[model samples]
Every structure is written in structure tokens, then in C-alpha cells.
Target: MFLWRALRSEGFPFVKKILLFALPTRLGGALGVQVILAALAPPGQAMLAEDFHRVLLSRALPAAVDGPDAAPAPEPLPSPGVPPTRLDELRKHVSKSALGMEIGPFHRPICPKREGFNCLTVDILPRDQLLQAYAEDKDVIPFQEHIEEVDVLLSSGLFASVAAYTQGQEARVQKAEGSLSYLISSHNFEHLPDPIAFLDDAATLLADGGFLTMAIPVGSRCFDCFRPLSTTGQLIDAHTSGRVKTTLGAIFDQSASAATHSGGQTIGDRNYDVAQVAVDACGGMIDESSFGALQFTHEFGHSGGIHSFVFNPYSFLLIIEDLQACGFLPLLRVQEVIDRPGQEFIVHIVKISEASRSPLPLDAARRTELLRQAIAYYIDDLNATRQLQNSP
Candidate 1:
């Protein structure tokens, strides 16, 4: 660790934070000296912390390796008679022999590098910056070692404040389409803007019969209890309308509807409805940073990091079925669902060839009845637990 006594002078706080963030980069490489020199820009021309941080990221990290070599994860891997009881157990089902591409594995990779599992890790930031991002909150990872190596820095160009970059041209720089054996993510599916687009993209990355195992936050069981469940129309509109980045409506709703679930124990802010607060403000004026409010005047990328979509497992299944029926996501099929009541649900989806395709009912009445039944899954689970807890 280079002591930045020369650069860490008293007056400039940005310098200190920038230098601290820069410390963990590939500082042993050729650009090591340049980073310090860059951080120490000419007197009046200092860059903002994020700008300087981006410059550091623009420097090369390790090249993304080709995906792991393995056979496809077993076709229709038998669902455990007893489902996994904890969120971490979601990783237990991922085939160690399978080559996997995992998304947004920020610090908690399902198939960690240390474990010797074959994975192509994709995220908004590389490993070192990921560590710096979580430096202040040490408890978030428990140990620094949990942060795994990021392989492919893929961004849907959604988060502009933090753009993902890599050294080479954006091609299949590491692996080819339909090359992966399986895909995995934990607690990431709900944050997507156009989930169908994402699923379609994921389908392209996997070989036929390859699986995508994802853990979705349960809307009713979590802080989103009062928020509206994601719909097939909303999911489709985001993709079809090309509002694939976080939408303005999403920003407004997030600012207006987000709740404090206090770790799924009690609804914290249900009484303090912010839509009323927005109305009480001047001219339907909500906060400027809100995606639906003033942020549109800025850029598309900064408008993200909002959970633009929300879902319970059942609602997700219903939407996936509808999307498939509509031929939106033609190749992906929902296979296994295991719910941990009051927490999240892990769904294992597999990619199949056209021969395996089946249409889900698209009739309005049939869809409504099915969706209502799906929504009831969460409501029933919530009421049953609440009634048991309240019983004398």
C-alpha cells in the first residue's frame, strides 16, 4: 500500500478518497505511477472522484478468460424433495462441473473463484473497485476474500454513473453464444428494467438445455409488500417501447412507493405515504433525483439503480409464461421454483430448442384467473405466518 502523504494533503478530501480508491487497482502494473500522477492533476484542473475513478477503471485488469469447460448441467436436475432453507443454499444446486456465466455477483458470487467453480463473472465493476465500493461497510461481506474476480464487464448501458468497461472491443470477447453450461444470479432478477430483454440475452448466452438459476425478492414477503406486483404488460412495454434503461415512471414509483420492511419483520413506512407528500409540495414536485422527476433532464444511465420491476415467485412465473406465450422470450423455460417464505424464491430456468416449446394460455380470462392464483401464493403465505404469530 503506497502511503499517499504527498497527495493526501489536508485540504482536498476528494483527493484522499480518490487516492484511497486508486490504491487497490493494478498498481503494480505500468499505469501504477500514472494513476498517482493522474490523481495529482494540475492545480486548477482536478477531476471529480467518480471521473478519476472511471479513469482508473479504464486501465486494464485481467483479461476475461474463456468460459469453463464442462458438460451441460444435468437435464431437469431433480428438484430436492426438501427445498434449500437459506438464501446461500441456492448455490448448492449449481453444477460445479458446468461452465457458468453469473451476473452482478458484486461481492457474493454463487460460484466463487476460491471454490474452483468454472464461471465467467459479469458485473458493473471489477473486483478491486467492488472492494472499494464496499470498504466503508465491512460487515456487508464479513471477509474481504468473499469478493470474487469479475471476468466480463457487461453493462446494459443502464447505470451511467458507474459504466462498466473492459479493455478489448465489445464483442464475444471471452465466450460465444450458446457456449455456457448454466447461468446463476442471486437477488438480481427484480432490479432489471426489461426483464424479458435480459432473459432473451441470457438465453442467447446459454447452450440449449443450459439453465439460469435466479433468486427473486418476494414482493409481498419483503419491503415491496405494498408495492404493485410486476405485470406482463409492464415487462413487455419496457422492452418493446425501448425504455430498457430505468424508466421515468420507475423512478417516480420508487421515490413514492418504496417501503421500509426492516428485514421483512414489519412495514416501517407504510403510514408515511410519499405520494401525498409529493402533492403537498409545489406543482406535483417530487425530489429532483427521482428517476420520474427531474433526473430525465440529465442522462439515461444515472436514472438507473432503481428496482424498476418487482415480483413474487408466482407473479414471475405467470409473467414468464405469458412472455413465452407471446413469443417474447421464445427459448427460455421456467423449470424449478423453491420459495423461502418471507425471504426470496430461487427459480431455475432452462433454455430449450424450438422442439421443446409450448404456449402458455394467452386468453384474457384464463390469464386473469391464473395471475390471481399466482398472486395468492404470496398473500396466503403472508397471512398464514401472520395469523400463526398473532395467535394467543
Candidate 2:
């Protein structure tokens, strides 16, 4: 102990400063210096404070080797319920997964709430308009490589913007067949320069097995003439049928409807009924025999402030059956009906493949299930809209 104390006293070369500044007293300073020096200068060489004694004697040094006993490993994450190989199913799964991730950590995805309207909202909107937007914005995902041309992008007057776009692509003409691609102008189909003749030309222009997609309103009839009135307006009266009344009111404000008929094609006191006109505008480019697939999207409320109407989901189903009866088969699939946040639609996607087959036979039970889901989806969406509306 005496030798240890002596050696420790010599450790820090600055003993006087340590005593004056660090320790406050000469004796205590010397004591600290001796202690530190004793701890550091080999175990036996010790002096001064108890702090120094503990430092030298402690055996807390870490070892490099792992001990024989170790905690068990954690379990792995489970595999996804869905298989990722099928394109349609895979797309659905990926979209759902990506959407789930976008929400904040605390919230889980609840079924989308419905807005007050006629039809359950669809995932796809303003179908042709949306397509054109994607095309104009360079946002389309070209699934097949070397698309010589888009087969046929059929449309109604609503897609007039797309028609003008096709006309502008004249440079790609010759093989372009651009005009054939723009078989639009549904409201004015009857007045087209040579309506029948134009359609004939379009038919001759389309290649075999080409696909034509259009977004035309589907219902008992299409009232072309404007009936410009708010849904709650007074011009609507006792004698007018709800369908015609809504059509006339929503499509036109009094001034626009008053304009002279552009030909027989003008929306007058006449009615263009059902979706057949949109299909018919294709000339023979598409018919029951060549009809590929049909997707019906319904939205109750729209930009024009039309009163909401129930989407006849049954009507669409009937159409599908009619197509099959007409010889086209393989309805193959039906998507989970969705109700968008503020719109009304039950959009259907029908893919026609020679080898395609319907997932299950259409029957009472299935139809009931579809109706239940659609209504439930809309109810939820309506609640959501109310919440959003009430929110500050």
C-alpha cells in the first residue's frame, strides 16, 4: 500500500495545478493525482482516493466471444393470400396494397364512403375523357409493345376533344387511319356529313380484331335537346316523365337548347335511346357478332347538376346476357363493385377472349349479392360525403 501510494503520487505530471485548480486544497489535489496515477500505472502501483482503488480492481472488460446460450430467432412474415401471377388479380392486389401504404400509420383502409346519387361510384370516371387525358398527358401504360395504332377509340359528343386530337394527328395518316379512329360525335351522329357513309368508311378502315372503347351514357333514352334547369327547378312539370324531364333539364340551359338544329342531329324534342346509338355509331365496325366486351359505368350526379338516378345494374347484367345470347361468350370476370367518394357509378369491365369463360353462372343468388354490395358501397360513400361536407 505504501509503495502503491508513492507511485500514484507521480502519475499526472501536473500535480500542483491539479491541487490548486482541480482539488481546491493542496492535500486533496495531491491525493487525487496519486489515486489516478496508482490506478493507471499497473495494478500494484496505487495511492490516494478510493475512486482510484475501484478503477484498478474492477473486471468489467467486454469479451469478443459469444456465449453458448442465445435468445431464439423471431418468426417470419406470412405470405400474401393472393398469388401474384394472374394479371387482373395482380393488378387489383397491387393497387390495393399501394393505396394502403399511402394512408398514415394510424389509419386502416375502410370501404370508401358514398355520395348522395343514383349509382355507386366507379373506379373509372369520364371514361373516354379520362382516356384522352391520359393520352394527352403521356400517362398511358402501353401494355403491348409496337402498338401500330390504337385500334379504334369510339366516342360520343362528350369526347369531341379527343376527335379534334385525332384530326391533328394527320401526319400519322395514310396508315394513320386517324378519322376512322375518331368515330365519335354521338349526339350529332345523324347529321354527320354523310352519317352512314362515314361509318362505312370507318368499318373499312379498322383492322380485324381491333378494340374500340367508348363512354356513352346508358339509359332508356338520351334526350339531345337541352332542358336547361337545375334539378330542383320549376320548369319541370306534372306531365313530363322523370327520364325525359331530367334529360331536358340537365343537358341544356334554355339558351343552348334554343339554338337551331345543326341538322337532324340536333337534340330537339327527340330521344336517342339506350347505349345502342353509341355502339351503332361504329357502323359495322362493331356488331353483336364482333362485339368484344362491354363495360357499363354509372354515375348519378355529374358536372351539369343532373338529379341522381339509380343505375340499372340489372340492365347492364341483362345486356351482358344478351351479348352472350347473340353468340359472344366468356364474360370471364366481374370486378368488386366500387362506390367512389362523390360520384355515382357501377363501372363494369368486360374482356372478350375466345378462350375466356365466365367465373360463375349468373343466377338469382349472385344477382342479389351484387345488388347488396352495390347498395352497401353507396351507403358507405354517402356517409363519407356527409362527413366530408360537415367537416370544416
Candidate 3:
């Protein structure tokens, strides 16, 4: 009974075939007949059971492997999320419904129709003058001419009143205040002799919930790479003294460090020729002696219109905080700062009322440290992006 059960359970078809064929041929007589009968008791039933077992085993054990103990392979892991590019990150922060004004949008306005931002673009030059300049050199325009149809709003007329920075709190307020929700100044802050005053005026121009979005070039990354970072103290002194002209020291530093590039291109794209230009502008070898006899004649030609202020992200934040501490009216609060790969960093500031201005929350040292950390993170991300692009 046990033998019969084992044969049936194991589906031993080969054993049955051997018993039926070999025994009948080798042992011819009663013994061979008895052996065949035992192997396949009910011959028709044995044949049917063998066929069914063969089909069932073939379908049940489908996998091909060395043994039952072998483990199955693991599935592949998912890819990591790609980090956002500098421009992509910047675009995410841009407001859509905000009614704002962009300054010095020569041709390519930062806030365009495609962005759905209700922004009015104004340049230092009038509409006709800007068009004439564009005709001479198309390269002067950075991106698309989104601001071509925008009316020519002069910088001087944008404010209600104009006074020197030294005049204090009164000059910070505007005469013709608008109901603007925001203000944008791209690559325009460095050109101003007094950035604090400009910022103060901008704050005054904005409505209660308004903000100012600005992009300023970092000295270490732009054409001003060779120039020393402007200190907060120097900016404070310049504003207090009410100096409109660029200092002799500033001019010398700029000329000495001025980067040279081929043809007409933005300052950001230019390569710095620090070695040659530094020696020439600084008189022989570059040293403190070069600035000793330098006079402020305001005769530096076209270079005069270049950067009046040079800063890195750290220094810029320092200056902004210091200005706030100096009791500049209308209170401009730093909302966001984005460090870009090229030459500039973008800062977004909101205007708060005088009542809200008192008891400033930010500690300058801690804030500066935080900004430095943020800048480092941005640099790492940018480097990683470049490495990924250059891979293979």
C-alpha cells in the first residue's frame, strides 16, 4: 500500500514504463505478468493517472533555477529627484497678480506678459532714446524686447520729490505716491550713488502690502571681480555725506579690476583681465601707492557709469540691515534673497508702516551668518548642476 501511494504521489511514470516494457520482454511467463499487474494495478486507470500527473507537474513547476534554496533577485530602485536650476527657482517666486513697476528694463523686461504680472517697465532713457540705442546695438538687449511697448517713465519723475540722502527722513518719502503693489530693479542698485536712499524711496512709493524685488551684481562674480567688497560703513558714510559723484578710490579700484571681454556683451559674461589691467590702472605694480595721488576729477569717461557699488551676498545683506537700523522711514523688510550662478543675486523686500518698523526683529550678525550659509548651499547646488551637465 505504501509503495503504491509513493509511486502515485511522486508521479513515477518512468518506473511504470520500465516495469511494463522491460519485465514483459526479459522475464516471459507468469512472473513477468504478475510484476506488470502489480506495477499498474487496473491497467486503464494507471495509464490515465500517469498522463494527468505529467501535465499537472509541467504546469505547476514553471520557474527555471538551480535549486529551491536560491533566492529571487531584487527590483531596481527609483531615481532621485533633480534639483531646481537657479532660473527655475527664481521664476517660482515671481508674483502673477502683483501690480508693480520695473526700473531700467532697456528692452527685455523681467516681468513680462507671459508671466501674467501686471508690471509697468520704465528705463532711465525715454522710449524714443531707448529705441534709438537698441537700433545701434541689438546685443544691448539681454532677453526678448518685452518692454518695447511700455511707456517711457523717467526715474526722476517716478518719485514725488527729490532730495539729497543727507536730508534724512523727509527725502525718503515720495511726493507722488502711487498705488503700486511692488517695484522691481534688476541690475540697477549698484549704479546708484546712494542705494539706501533709493530703497527708502521705493518703499515710500509702494502701497502698504507692496514689495521691492531687486537684482544686484556680486563683485566677486561680475566684471567687478577684482574690486574690493564695499563695506557697510563706507555705504553709510556715502549716504550721510550726500555724495553724488563716485569716489576717486572707487574709480581707481574699478579701473584696476575692470574685466575685459570681446565685443558687446553683458558684464556677467565678460572675463576678468585682472593681471594686465590692475598693473596699468594701478601704476606699475598693484599696491596702496597707486591710490595715494589719485584725484577725483570725474573724468573716467564711460567707466564712470559702471558699478558705483560692489558687493557679495554677505556684504549686501549687511548694508541693508544697517540702513534699517539707521531709522530710514517706511521700513523695508527683507523677505527673500536668491543667489544666482552668474554675477547677481535677487532680493525681495516688503514695505511696512512706521508703527511696525520699531523694534526690528533681525540680529545683523546672525542674519549675515544665515545668509552666508544659504549662499554656500546655492554654490554647492550650482556646482552639482554643472558637474551633471559635463558628465560623460
Which is the leading candidate under lDDT? 1
Clash count of each predicted structure: 1, 16, 2
How well does model 2 score by local distance difference test?
0.26
Kindly list the per-residue Cα lDDT of model 3 for residues 1-392, writing each as its tens digit: 22233355556655554553454432122221223445554654345343322221111211222343221221221222222354443333346676566777666666765567676556556666667756757576554354444433453534533222113453223333635667777788887777766776787677654667778887655667546667677777877887666676667766566764333344462233323222235545556565554552445433335578886655676566666566654366665454544677777666665445464445655565535533543343233334433456
TM-scores of all models? 0.65, 0.24, 0.58
- Tell how far residue 207 is off in model 1, in angstroms: 0.7
**What CA RMSD would you report for each candidate?**
22.6, 31.5, 28.0
Candidate 2: tens digits of C-alpha lDDT, residues 199-257: 33333333222212111222211232222111111212211222222343222222122
Whole-model lDDT per candidate:
0.57, 0.26, 0.53
Query: What value of lDDT does candidate 1 attain over all alpha carbons?
Result: 0.57
Question: Any runs in candidate 1 off by more than 4 Å, and if so which?
Answer: 1-82, 85-89, 157-174, 261-304, 358-366, 381-390
Give the Cα-based TM-score of candidate 1 against the true structure.
0.65
TM-score of predicted structure 2: 0.24
